[model samples]
Target: MTEKRSPWRAIVLVSTISSYIVGGTVGGVFLGLWLGNQFGAKPFFLITFLLFGLATGFYGVYRAIEPFIGDEKKR
Candidate 1:
């Protein structure tokens, strides 16, 4: 028999995933900004780091959700 997933589990999963993406992006941007300020190359560093953060965030989301995707496919 199929069992219902707990709401708490879903909430936690969503929260975790969102946190991962947001954290990566924010961290990257801030770090880039700081570095850029030091180097006096604001836009260059900011854009580079922003893109890197976006890639990292997406990758994290993909990895985190992969298992769930596999499970759904099996069913």
Candidate 2:
């Protein structure tokens, strides 16, 4: 028998997911900015890295939620 998760667990999970996305995007932005400044191509690197970061963030969210998803399927 599976135990039900607490509401606090859900809240914490949501917070974690948001943090992952935000941290990744912010980190990417900073890295892109630095690279752009070094290479004299601000807009290009900024957009490229921004998208990459967003994608990475989503991937992290997927990974974090995968276990819960599996549990639901089992139920």
Q: Return the TM-score for each candidate structure.
A: 0.85, 0.86
Query: What TM-score does structure 2 among the candidates reach?
Result: 0.86
Model 1 ranges off by over 4 Å: 1-4
Index of the highest-TM-score prediction: 2
Across residues 1-75, which tens digit of lDDT does each residue of candidate 2 receive?
224577877898899899989988998899999999999999999999999999999999999998788666766
Candidate 1, 1-75: lDDT as tens digits: 244357876787798799888988998899899999999999999999988998898899888877677565575
- The best candidate by lDDT is 2
- Candidate 2: worst-modelled 10 consecutive residues by lDDT: 1-10
Query: Which residue pairs collide in model 1, if any?
Result: none
RMSD values, in order shown: 2.0, 2.1
